[model samples]
Target: QENRITTVQCLSGTGSLRVGGEFLARHYHQRTIYLPQPTWGNHPKVFGLAGLSVKTYRYYAPATRGLDFQGLLEDLGSAPLGSVVLLHACAH
Candidate 1:
C-alpha cells in the first residue's frame, strides 16, 4: 500500500489571499469584511466583487504617517463578532 498527497499552489501571496477571502465570502457566513484604512487600493474592490460588504478600520495615522496601533485595535475590538478582517502581509 502507498499513501500520496497532493497540493495546489495559487499565484503568490496576493493571489492566494484574494482567493482565500473570496472562498470565505462564498462558503462561509461572512457578510461584512473590514479592511485597513490606506490598504492596497484594490482590496475593497476585490472583496466587494466577492459579495462581501467592505468597510475600513483605522490603520494609518496621517499625523505621523505611521501605523495607528491604538486606533486599529479599537476598531477591531469594536467590530461585530465573526466579521472578516483583511490584513496585509506588507504594509502598503
Candidate 2:
C-alpha cells in the first residue's frame, strides 16, 4: 500500500518553510528543529521566526563537495526524538 501526501500552496520556498514552521510551532510539542548544514540561506530565519530552536546537522562535505553521510548520521542519531528536521532535498 502507498500513502498520499498533502501539500500547501505558497509563494516560494521561503514562504513554504515559514508557513510549515509556524504550523509546527503552533501545534507540535517539540520546539527544537534540526536543519541540514549549508542549507538554504533563508532556512534559519524562517524557522526562527516560528519560535523554534534551530540547529544544524551535518550535510555538506566540504572535502568532497557532496553529502557527508557519516557526519549526518551522527548528528541525526544524537537528536532528540520528535525534533523537527528541515531537509534540503533539492535546489528546486
Candidate 3:
C-alpha cells in the first residue's frame, strides 16, 4: 500500500476546552459560557479556570437518560443575549 501521512497530537479534552474558554474570556466582553447539566466531570472547573463564569442548562434527564429538550429550551430562553451555550457533540 502507498504510504499515508497523518498527524496526531494527544491532548485532554478538558484541557483544550479550558484553553479555548480562556482565550474567549480574554478577548470577549460580557460573554457567558453555559455548560450542560451532568456534563464532563471537569467541565465546570475547566471553564472556571479560564476566568469565565460557567452556567448550567438542563441537558440530561435521570428518568430518560436523555436530553431534556424543553428544559434546555427554557434555559436558553432565559440566558442573556451574547451567551455562549455548549452542547455535547453527539447528544443524540
Candidate 4:
C-alpha cells in the first residue's frame, strides 16, 4: 500500500500553527478559523497574521474544571461548511 497523506514539515506549536495558517489562507475557500476558547494564547495572533479571521468556540468550563462538551458541540455545529478548526494535538 502506498501512503496517501502529504505532510509539510515545520517546528512544533506556534511555528506549526503559523505554517498551517498560512497554507489555509492561501488555499482554503473559507478564511474563517475557529479555535476553542481558552486555547493557547498564541493562536489568535498566529492565524490572524496568516490572513484568516479568528473565531472562538466554547471549550473549558471552570465549574466542572473540564471540557464543556455541549457548548463545544453547539459552537461547532453552527460553523459554516469548510471553516478551518484549530484543535489541540491529542497529547497536548
Candidate 5:
C-alpha cells in the first residue's frame, strides 16, 4: 500500500492559510470552515476567497478578557461532523 502526501512551501501566514483553504475546499467533504470568533481580521477574507464557507466558533471573551473555553467547546461540539476548524496556536 502506498500513501502519498504532497507538501508545498508557503511564503507567509496568509498565503499558507489560503493554500490550506483551497486544498480543503477541493478535498474535504464538509465545505464549511470554523474560525475563532476573535481571529485575525483578514482570516475570513482569506478563507472565503479561497472558496470555503466561513463560520465562527466562540473563542475570546471580551468581557472577561480571556478565552471562552466552555463556549468554544460548545460551539465546536455543535459543528457538523467532518467540518474543518482553523485553530490559532499563538498570537496573531
Candidate 6:
C-alpha cells in the first residue's frame, strides 16, 4: 500500500508551521520535531508551544554555501525513530 500524506495551505510560513506542529503534536506518536539548522528564528518557539520538543539537524554548509549532505545524513540517521523533520524546499 502507498503511504498517505496530507497537505494544507496557510496564510504564511509561520502559520503553516504552527498548524502542522499542532496537528502533529496531537496525532503523531513522535513528540519531537527536528528542524534544519539555521531555520527561522521563531521555529523553536512555535513548535515548543505546540508541545513538541524542537531539535535541529545539520543542513547548511557555510564553507561551500551549500548543503552539508554527509552531516545531514549523520544527524538524521541518529535521530530517534518516528521523529519529525521539517525540510525547506524551493518551489521555483
Best by lDDT: 5
Please estimate how well model 6 matches the true structure, expressed as its whole-model Cα lDDT: 0.90
TM-score of each: 0.78, 0.87, 0.81, 0.88, 0.90, 0.86
Q: Which candidate would rank higher by lDDT, 1 or 5?
A: 5
Candidate 2's residue-wise lDDT over 25-91, tens digit each? 9999999899988887888888999998899999988898888999989999999988888777772
Error of 3 at 78 (Å): 0.7
How much lDDT does candidate 5 score? Answer: 0.91
Ten contiguous residues with the weakest lDDT in model 4: 83-92
Worst 10 residues of 6 by lDDT: 83-92
Residue 35, model 3: lDDT of 89
Candidate 4 residue lDDT tens string, 1-92 = 79598888888879998999999999989999999888878899999999999999988888988888899899999999877898865522
TM-score of 6: 0.86
lDDT of 3 by residue, 54-87 (tens): 8999988889988898999999999998888888
lDDT of 6 by residue, 1-66 (tens): 689896788989899889999999999999999999888789999999999998899999999888
Once model 3 is optimally superposed onto the true structure by TM-score, how far is the C-alpha of residue 33 displaced, in angstroms? Answer: 0.9
What local lDDT score does residue 1 receive in model 4, on the 0 to 100 scale?
Answer: 70
Q: Which has the greatest TM-score?
A: 5
Candidate 5 vs. true structure, TM-score: 0.90
lDDT of 1 at 71: 97
Instruction: State residue 6's C-alpha deviation in candidate 6, in Å.
Output: 6.1
Summed over model 2, clashes come to 0
Mind giving the per-residue lDDT tens digits that candidate 5 earns over 1-92? 58988779998999999999999989888889999988889999998998999999999888888889999999999999888999988733
* Candidate 4 displacement at residue 7 in angstroms: 2.0
